[model samples]
Target: MSDSPAGQAAQKNAPHTITLLQHNALKGFLLAAAGLFLFACMDSTTKYLTTHYNVPFVVAMRYIVHFLLMVMILAPRHSAQLVYTQRTGLVVARAVVLTIASLCMGMALHRMPLAETTAINFLAPTLVALLAGSMLGEKIGGWGWAAIVTGFIGVLLIARPGGGLDAVGIMFALGAAAANATYQLLSRLLASTEKAIALLFYTALLGSIIFGIALPWFWENEAPSELEVILLLSMGVSGGLGHYLFTLAYRHAPASMLAPTTYLQLLWAGLLGWIIFDTIPDSMSLIGMAIVAASGLIIAFKSH
Candidate 1:
């Protein structure tokens, strides 16, 4: 039987239920922002380390540390299960995609400023949204096309002729974005059958194993200072922790709400770039950054 009129009225009058949801959503937003900031820190540190080390070396050290940390943190709770997966091939494929994305991003940082490389990487989400129709079987409608075009225009602005941008750097950054989009799509495909920790574990483990094979060829054997070694380790730590925060945030909020917050990483990237490398975006680049962010925000809101 339905609730009595008084009970229904009482439930309607209760504000705490609404308050709780609002509180949780707010917490999600803050957590996402914090995660993005942490990731920005990771990128800044990666860029700094690349100046003293090769991209392969930096990437290998990062995943090795990440793998060790995962074993230490997750082994107690999910030792054997860490590698358990219903879709082993997809899992390995996902890892390969992310590993390639990491390599491209590292190379981009080696050639481009942190903010610009980051700006280009921001295209990942827009691509994901546009491809969702064909890839994820979700319709994007007209607004999605507009957002895609807007994002592309923003990229053109930043990568315009004689913008002092390296051709190879721009290419690498675009490659990273495309690979990252593939990674996101694979994560979605595995979301139903795979544990989040399992995916994380494999990404780090596979990256470490694959890169370890090539480490000997690229190893410079330079004795990094104490600070450099610490910084390199911090890169992996920040990456693992940042992704953890992002996962936790989604537990409290939907992806649509969190999508817009991802753009905040660009701002964090710009600030950290200036502080660490004294690199500032030019006026035109800043405008381009604003446009890219606006396009992402539009899609996020529209998706809602």
Candidate 2:
């Protein structure tokens, strides 16, 4: 009745292996949660920096740090095939659009309340739905169209053209939304064949190059304080890590399951806004945020 050596080993190690796997899964979920929180911190810091510094200078510095960080992260995972890919065109297009989105969001952050800026940016999902329908010929049903229209109305409420709108902020947020929509569409097109790391690597590389050319013109007369520089560096790290964890979460779970989790970002945004700047979004802004969130959540549920 004695067991063979191999059978004994298997029995002895199986429980430990299962425990290790469970630990790893839990670790991944915790990392994703931390990433989301850091991303909110990054947004809050960007808003703070823009209040004291020039938007272009702050933005360019942010990208430069982010680009360098991405390269360092990718060098270890090096693949020569990164430069040559079937989705090269789409990658480049996505990078250009992302660059525009970043710049516009920078402007919005500088000119508007943190929560308001974040709320306006929510329009991107709705825009993505419409863009997919028009550009990719995806079939969007009646509810999708309704959601899209409601999202736009939310945008209008925030913009409130005649009512103390910061013209630059409003325009920047709109431009960011459009670019974000384009980026999402391009991501869907490339997801099947391109490695996620490769796509992210090129996007950061190309974005750095595009922003590099313009950095000189916006260079500041005085360097940022050491503490400020540290925060700026953290911003890049936070953003890059957030995207990485988000990609990982998508692999582990379905989009529908993860979609609701993203709404946590708004709560983080609001908390950070209050803690750092003592700025609370007004009643109108909160109403707009509710509308945008409702529309996006409705679309997510409907799509499911």
Candidate 3:
């Protein structure tokens, strides 16, 4: 009954190992939940801004504030190197896509109900599943295909071709979904080798530059009030912080484990929309959201 050295070491480490695993799991769940909360908050803030301000002006200001905050936070730690990157093209592409997505989401927020816009954005995950198979050569099975189709159908239910279609709003939502899919796919490609902090730093820096150039065309005649400016600033800071937490979440657990939790954002969006604007979604909208959420949850579970 004598224990070997390796067995003794394993026994000694067992409790510590179990404790570490539990800590990581709890951290991942908390990070994922926080990320969702921040995202919902960003959407709510954007909706508020768009109600009273030009979409582009709000978007530009938000990115500018985000860029400045990132510089303030990361510059002391890593100077000009924040913009230095071997993947310059990839970085630029990510920035462009993200800026465009933000613009489109802003437009959607201006015109559509918040919950509906959030639900449509969730279509990005399904698009990511398909793109991973095609662009990244991942093996997505039959269930993945089914989920993609089901999710698209839910979008159609919301858009309602001829019934409730606000062509501009629907198009904006779709564009946002596409941009989000591209962003997620690029993140997956980079995550295998790049440091998460570096990736995020570059995204904020480049996004600021790209959006900065575009800001002149959309600048408003009147400056935003103090309260509007504060919300815009909060949006950028929260968005950047959320991205950081999400990166931490992935380090602790598989994406599949945390993916389904994103549906919680729809609920948050719905509640925010109701309270802030007294915007209650109709029965059809609720049903459409349910379909989208259920299909997305199934997709996340099946892919896992």
Candidate 4:
């Protein structure tokens, strides 16, 4: 209500600032959604590639190319911020966690269908909501708990006995889910001090080094065809771009609030699995996927 020049400037800028914030929120949501789809593409491609190569090699190639792409693109833009972080130990730990996730997911994809594998992984977001309270000090209400429980039930239906999914693959998928949940929580915590690019960079760096050393063990000496070459390279682009978008999204929005948006991954995975592999989830698994997605959506949108 002040009539001063500074006061008038503040008033004029208020609406613009509010509009900017809204635009960022919208952008973040779209990015998060698209990121998940790319992730589905990455996983589907991995599932296809794993049939021809070992898990470590597939993962190493993904990260090696990912690291190179970051150097070529993100490094120039972000400069030191891409290579440095206040939380050095935490950044390394987060990268290791993601590496574990990539390895587990790769192993799972070796035998599992893309849609089922991805639906199982959607448990990560619900698990994040469940753990946010204790790990990140974020509050979760009764509805959040309900959603988490529902998500578990959905996963159960998909992995139930006589469901035709491989037991080992299911176990690996569960491991990937746990690691991914931890990675998401760590990302949310680090976003306070670390730039998304820094977190992303360290992850690719660690993945590259860790898997690169073991590359000889799982090396495919026969050489890949043109299609295989494209798929291998696409993994890096999709993974790097997907995680960057997801990181930016969580930086702008709470991890829990952004949980529902990740369900788009289920849609993409199902579509890609069908199109690329000529596979579809059975009735039971489809129902389970629906149950899990609905629960996570309910939990995320409960307080939004």
lDDT, candidates in the order shown? 0.80, 0.68, 0.74, 0.85
Question: In order, how many clashes per candidate?
Answer: 0, 0, 0, 0
Q: In terms of lDDT, which candidate is stronger, 1 or 3? A: 1
- Predicted candidate 4 versus true structure: per-residue lDDT over 1-304, tens digit per residue: 2224764455456522211112255777888998998899899889999999898999999999999999998777767668756668989999999999999999999979999988888789888898888886766788888888888999999999999999999999999999999999888877655667888999999999999999988898889999999999999999999998898887677777777678888999989989999999999999999998899778766834
lDDT of 2 by residue, 1-304 (tens): 0034664355355522211111133444465466668767878888988877877777777777877886676665665434544557877888788888888988998888877777777677677776676675655567767877887888778777664658888889888877866766676555444455667677668767887888888877887799898988987787666665654543343333233345557778888899898988777877877787777667656644
Which candidate model has the greater TM-score, 1 or 3?
Answer: 1
Find the 10 residues in a row with the least total lDDT in model 4: 15-24
lDDT tens digits by residue: candidate 1, 1-304: 0134763344346522212122267887888788899889988999999999999999999999999999988899888668876679998999999899999999999999999999988788777777766875755656667877998888788888889989999999999999977876676556545556778888888999999999999997779999998998998899877766765565455444455467899999999999899999898889989998998778766754
**What order do candidates take by TM-score, descending?**
4, 1, 3, 2
Over 4 Å off in model 4, which ranges? 1-25
Clashes of 4: 0
Better of 2 and 3 by TM-score: 3
Evaluate model 4: give its TM-score.
0.90
- Candidate 3, run of 10 with poorest lDDT: 14-23
Per-candidate TM-score against the hidden true structure: 0.86, 0.80, 0.84, 0.90
- Candidate 2 off by > 4 Å: 1-38, 81-84, 134-139, 247-263
**Pairs of residues clashing in candidate 1:** none
Each candidate: RMSD = 8.1, 8.6, 7.5, 6.1
What is the lDDT, from 0 to 100, of the residue 168 in candidate 3?
A: 90
**Residue pairs whose backbone atoms clash in candidate 2:** none
Ranked by lDDT, top first? 4, 1, 3, 2
Among these predictions, the greatest lDDT belongs to 4
TM-score of 1: 0.86
